[model samples]
Target: MKFLDQAKVYIRSGDGGAGSVSFRREKFIEMGGPDGGDGGRGGDVWAEAVDGLNTLIDYRYQQHFKAATGGHGMGRLRAGANASDIVLKVPAGTQIFEEDNETLVADLAKVGDRFRIARGGNGGFGNAHFKSSTNRAPRHANPGQPGEERWIWLRLKLIADAGLLGLPNAGKSTLLAAVSAAKPKIADYPFTTLHPQLGVVQVGNHSFVLADIPGLIAGAHEGHGLGTRFLGHVERCAVLLHLIDVTAEDPVAAYRVIRKELKAYSPELAAKPEVIAFNKTDLLSTEAIEDKLKDFKRRVRKTPLLVSGATTMGVPAAMKKLLEVIDASRRGDRPADAPGITTEEWRP
Candidate 1:
């Protein structure tokens, strides 16, 4: 199925059924009292986060969803049948927003999570309910309440333990492919991977999920070069693997550009635990690599790791470090080396 992270949907709850206006008309009874029955309640509209779904492509074709209206009440004190509810199954980590897209209605981050988006209208009372001691028989019945209707937005963000970040052609996909079973598209050119890909990496006795998204360019926060839309996929990651191309001239500058984009998009993302690695080490000579590492250390204020995704060199060490940070994050201990967003409103 095609990937669709965002979709706009129009949803409406079912309207309640009208109450019946009838009297007890028996051949033996001379005076008949009001015996109208109450109407049935309408159906509700709900959203559920279920398994086996990772995309919102299904919502792309169907934009409108309406529940079944309740059945009208019958004569002779016969109640109407209640309408069944409608549930919209969405992927985990899907966030529901109001029409403005700013007000968050629900955050479904786990499987089987459910939220009622619209409530069914209440059923109206029958004529018998309005009958009092002063009035013997009532001729009027109350009408059913109208259902609610509104437009909502659904946004999905993938959940992963770690995320890979880099500029285009910086070998982010290569590292994920080498450590995990995911087969992300790799090419010599830039922007080879347009969609976000997920992988599970194993290090020693533990394994953690990893996500790889398209590279970020300058002014990505302002909608530049695919913008920072895909960044939402990694917002929940405990740590970020920042890869820089060692073959690029002034790799430090390239690193700073991505950092700027991250900070621009969200300070919470910028503050995440970052593990910097100089990729494509096989293409650089020992002397050249040593010099670039020293330059990066001075500029970034931290020692960077050397990893060759193609040759799988120094990848084990990178995975181990990522696992360490992930474990620390899971333990509720925010290590100095890995401080990510903890106060983000929703996973998406």
Candidate 2:
């Protein structure tokens, strides 16, 4: 599995069957009436959300999907069989968009969620239905209706309780691997983690999902350096963990760069609850870390936590603080420890 979060596919529903045009001709009954049967209905095309799938790579190879057509009607007042429906299984949180790519068609958030992409055509009437007292020998039969067809776009957005946000090589992967079971590829260079990795962090009896997206850089909104492709994964998160590398030449500048990119991509994302963490504390001296913390507090008017992913220093405390923030967010209350400026109206 190559990770593919977006794809475009053409889908078509089955067409209805044609009606039969026959008359009952028996040896004893010389004057028989029409005995044509009605046609069967066509099959529908539906998209369903299922578990165990996190990507849309399957749609890349296969771009066209068509349902089975209905069977034709038969004589002797016998109806044709209905066609079988075609079901497409997609990952949860898959959003269906129209051909324009901006209009939303459906948003599948939960498992087993389904939406009908194309509707089947209705069956046609037979000659027997038109037979009446005035018109005994009817020979008219209608053809089946054509099925609907359209091209749709599928986009996946990962759902999580908390998301990690930072510039490249900001120790996000290290922090996630240290706190959760996720084993993302780590390297000293930037863009080591290509796709988003999800992990479940258990605190006592409670557990919440955390998503680690690829590092974002300046001009991310203009489709630079992986662009804002992975930013949609964090749109559903309740809280954001902002990790700033303390060893950077100017930690404040790095922090501001990421924040500018986030706000440019989506103001709502920047407005989400954020927890600031000064990572890579093991690489800096106590005096240096204290000086940087003091500068950050003066600029942001809030105290940031110092954590070392390599040495696991203050990691537990960071996890506890994240949990508390998530709990407060669930209760519709802003977290006191790390608060964000409200920029938009809360939907729910």
Top-TM-score structure, candidate number: 1
**Candidate 1 lDDT over residue span 168-268, tens digit each:** 99999998899999999889888898889999998877999999999999888998888999999999899999999999999899999999999988899
Candidate 2 is scored at a TM of: 0.92
Could you give candidate 2's per-residue lDDT for residues 166-253 as a string of tens digits?
9989998998898888899999999999999998888778888889999998889999999999999998888898999999888888
Candidate 1 Cα misplacement greater than 4 A, ranges: 333-348
Task: Give the Å shift of residue 59 in candidate 2.
Answer: 1.3
Worst lDDT window (10 residues) for model 1?
339-348
Deviating ranges (above 4 Å) for candidate 2: 331-348
Score residue 67 of candidate 1 by CA lDDT: 87
